[model samples]
Target: MQPRLNFYKASQEAYNAVKNLENYVQGCGLEPRHIHLIKLRASIINHCAYCIDMHVKESRHDGLSEQWINLMSAWEESPIYDDKERALLTWVDAVTRVADTHVPDSAYETLKAHFTEEDMVKITVAIGVINIWNRLCVGFRAMHPIDQPAKAA
Candidate 1:
């Protein structure tokens, strides 16, 4: 599908502001895998294909196994995730669907067990950042690159 608009080109200053947040998130002490997983899960809930594709590629580049990546949508039932990962995913769900979930206290309690207060703030910011990106990309109809492998010819 064709894109509705080039958001970055439309406003480079605003785009750079977003990029600055991304840079902060990159060094926020969370594992790269965790960051990507959060991004992927949030993107999935937001139905942002561009972000899903981007994070899947980033997850792979960070050496996460295909099995781990494939189980993202079914994370609640999957055994691959550790306690911390599970907690993060739960938080991602609660926050990403905040309108519906209101980020229930139960989810916060669970996340607290896995993350320090500072870490929790960082994680929440990361989630918020991704949701904003999802809204922009989905709203603007940003197209993800096609998945086909390159031709040998």
Candidate 2:
């Protein structure tokens, strides 16, 4: 599919805002796999092919097992994910699919059980950033690079 616009060039400020989110994700104590999982989950909710391809590949590069990545879409029943990971993934899905499933109190309570209030805010921020990027990429049809591979050695 053709992109509607080149947001990176057309809106430098907006691109910077999105990039800042990446910086925040890097600085957060969350593991690379966790961050990538959140990104992939958000992309899936938004149906952003560009992001799904990019993040899925990145997750693999970061040594996230293919089994875990494959199970992410059905994380509720997947035994590969730990308690903290499960909480964060649930949060990601709820946040990304907010219109359909508003983040319930149970989600918040579950997340609070694993993360401090500050960490929860950070996690929310990370999710929010992914959601924003998903919207922008999907809206603008931001295509992934053609040479990008699904996995890297």
Candidate 3:
């Protein structure tokens, strides 16, 4: 589907502000893989194909195996994630679905056990940033690029 509007062109200032937050998230001391997981998990929840495509590529670039990436969507059922990743995924769910979850104390406490206060704040912001992008992309029907089929060798 074509995008309903070009957010960057519609309001450069607004888009730039979001970009600034994105930059901060990249350097916010969280591991790159964790950041990718946050973005991907939230995108999955929001059903934003654009973001799912982007973060999956980024996650792969950061050395996350396809199994790790795919299993994240079913993390609770999978035995692959470590304690810290489980905590991170829990918080991503809590914050991404805050309306339903109310950002539960159990999730927060779980995150706190794995991260410092600063790291927790950064992670929350990272989640918020992705949610923001998810809304914009979903609201606008931002279409992801189609991949060409692999050519025969």
Q: Largest TM-score belongs to which candidate?
A: 3
Instruction: Let me know the TM-score candidate 1 reaches against the reference structure.
Output: 0.94
Full ranking by TM-score = 3, 1, 2
lDDT of 2: 0.85
Q: Quote the RMSD, in angstroms, for model 3.
A: 1.0
The predictions' CA RMSDs to the true structure, in order, are: 1.8, 2.9, 1.0
lDDT of 2 by residue, 1-153 (tens): 899999989989979988987797889897677788788888887898899888889889988889988877788887889999888988888887788788888888889899889888888888998888888898999988788457875
Two-way lDDT contest, 1 vs 2, winner: 1
Model 2 lDDT at residue 47: 91
CA shift of 101, model 3, Å: 0.7
Q: Is candidate 2 or candidate 3 better by lDDT?
A: 3
What's the C-alpha lDDT at position 108 in model 3? Answer: 91
> Total clashing residue pairs per candidate?
0, 0, 0
Ranking 1 against 3 by TM-score, winner: 3
Instruction: Assess each prediction's global lDDT (C-alpha) against the native.
Output: 0.93, 0.85, 0.94
Ten-residue stretch with the least lDDT total in model 1: 28-37
